[model samples]
Target: MAKERSIPAPMANPETEPFWAAAREGRFLIKRCTACGKAHWYPRACCPHCMSEATEWVESPGRGTIYSLSVMKRAPEVYAVAYVTLEEGPTMMTNIVECDYDSLAIGQAVQIAWRPTAEGGPPYPVFKPR
Candidate 1:
């Protein structure tokens, strides 16, 4: 039996509200440091690269390659988790959805897919084979 995966709602704070907002709007966003011209995941106020406060949100193309992955078949629901390297240069830990877990591979191309929170909060980004 294929059980549905339960997605937990992500908590939002002052630092991450905009990111959740954009996700609700069906857009993917990442933080980029103006000081060092580097993009990063898990958006923050200060640039992780240069330690600069000049950071801004940018819409991502919502496409990436799988850096690594693991499929958990023994869980309550079968699901795949992966580290995806975004075209913008940041690798994010995310769920791989809408595909056969056994067929997933490293370096597989993917695009953004959304799953609504179990509590009806903002939807979070997942990925499907592109």
Candidate 2:
């Protein structure tokens, strides 16, 4: 059997460390503002809506729909990338895997998955048909 190649893990800073750490344990974290009850992406320290620093990290259900998608046919291996709107109400950019690229459709049901990264750093979220 052929060996699989690894991709570089995402770089985590102070602001995103918690999210990445939780991902290592197969958990997805979302932040909800204590002030406005709104959730935002990219794991900022403050709520983008209320500008409040009291955001709390909460576990996500890790299910979502494909808000949009594009297949990169030029790649040596075909892959589809898309915006997934989580059940928690945040949209994140992710790769759709474990299926044919042409099978992807907007609003299709999906579930969050994790893939190991290069150099044994951490696993990152990907999406597969649910």
Candidate 3:
């Protein structure tokens, strides 16, 4: 297989460490606001919905539908960037991989696939068409 394309490691902080840690373990997670019962990505201390500071990390179902996509044919390797709307209703930015780039489409079903990167901090979450 081609070397996995990598994004830089996220700088883990107290609030987001749980997310980074889970990624290292080949799992995906999101922050769910305890007060508002809303799930969100880009882990944070406060809920974007109700502005509540109460949130907890929850395992993501690791499945989503492609909300949008852009193919990078000129890159060293063909790749796609996409916003995947997760099953729990949060849209997260991720890459769509392991298939022909021309085959991807908006609303295509996808599932998370962890890829180890050069950064070595945590394997990043990309997706494969489901």
Candidate 4:
């Protein structure tokens, strides 16, 4: 098996600690605004929709379709980075693995798989073809 990469430690502020904890448990979470019924990423204390402090954390299905992608040919190694628009309406920056760089397409179905990190932080959520 390939060695997993190290993920950087989260800042661990009050707003984002719960999110980091959830990711360590192999679950993906997003902040949902109770007031406006909208979900958002990069968790914040207040809802971006209504600026209300009424927000809650909810588990995500870890499923999404590729919204956009870039093939890195000049970077450290050949890899693909994508903005995956989650079914719950938040687009997250993630890496797409287990597929050839030339084979990825927009709107391709993907499911999350946790890649363990050597940094002792949360595992990185990577997408693979479903």
Candidate whose TM-score is highest = 1
Lowest lDDT 10-residue stretch of candidate 1: 1-10
- The candidate with the higher TM-score, 2 or 4, is 2
TM-score (C-alpha, index-matched) for candidate 4: 0.87
Q: Which pairs in model 3 have colliding backbones?
A: none
Report lDDT (CA) for all predictions: 0.92, 0.86, 0.86, 0.84
Pairs with steric clashes in candidate 1: none
Best lDDT goes to which candidate?
1
Specify the poorest-scoring 10-residue window by lDDT in model 4.
Answer: 1-10
Q: What would the per-residue lDDT of candidate 2 be over residues 56-97, giving only the tens digit for each residue? A: 998888899999999876534667879999987889998888
TM-score to native of every candidate shown: 0.95, 0.91, 0.91, 0.87
User: Which rank order by TM-score, best down to worst?
Assistant: 1, 3, 2, 4
lDDT of 1 at 78: 87
- Itemize residue pairs with steric clashes in candidate 2: none
Better-scoring candidate (TM-score), 1 or 4: 1
* Cα lDDT tens digits for candidate 4, 9-113: 556788888877888888988999999999997789888778999999999999999999997775346667899999999899998888777889999999998
Number of backbone clashes in candidate 3: 0
User: Which runs in model 4 stand beyond 4 Å of their true positions?
Assistant: 1-6, 74-76
